[model samples]
Target: MRTRVWDKMIHLPVKYFDEVKTGEMSSRLANDTTQVKNLIANSIPQAFTSILLLVGSIVFML
Candidate 1:
């Protein structure tokens, strides 16, 4: 994901680089990728487990 982001950034016109600060871009790259990694690594599995537990409880209750 970081590589893809970097590739996209590299392809952008020089005008964009001139307009945006390097620090801001770096922060955006780091923060956005981290959020995505967290969602995939932590949130998705937790959500799946929660759903499975919910279904199991419902079945056992019935």
Candidate 2:
């Protein structure tokens, strides 16, 4: 699901985009990819770890 969404975003037609005309495509590509990287690099692992910890604690408590 995420991969499909990201593939669509990455393959978006840049030839006629307003941002491309305005010469902002570089920034858009760089910043958008960076934001996505931050989520995948940081948030996903943290979320997975937190969920695992919570489940482990609950099971231990029981």
By TM-score, who's the top model here?
1
What lDDT tens digits, residue by residue, belong to model 2 across residues 1-62? Answer: 34555566677777546445444655555676788889999999999999999999999999
Worst 10 residues of 2 by lDDT: 18-27
lDDT of each model, Cα atoms only?
Answer: 0.96, 0.73
Q: Among these predicted structures, which one has the highest lDDT? A: 1
lDDT of 1 at 56: 100
The residue pairs that clash in candidate 2, if any, are none
Q: What is the C-alpha RMSD of each candidate to the true structure, in Å?
A: 1.3, 4.9
Instruction: Give the per-residue lDDT digits (tens) of candidate 1, residues 1-62.
Output: 99999999999999999999999999879999999999999999999999999999999999
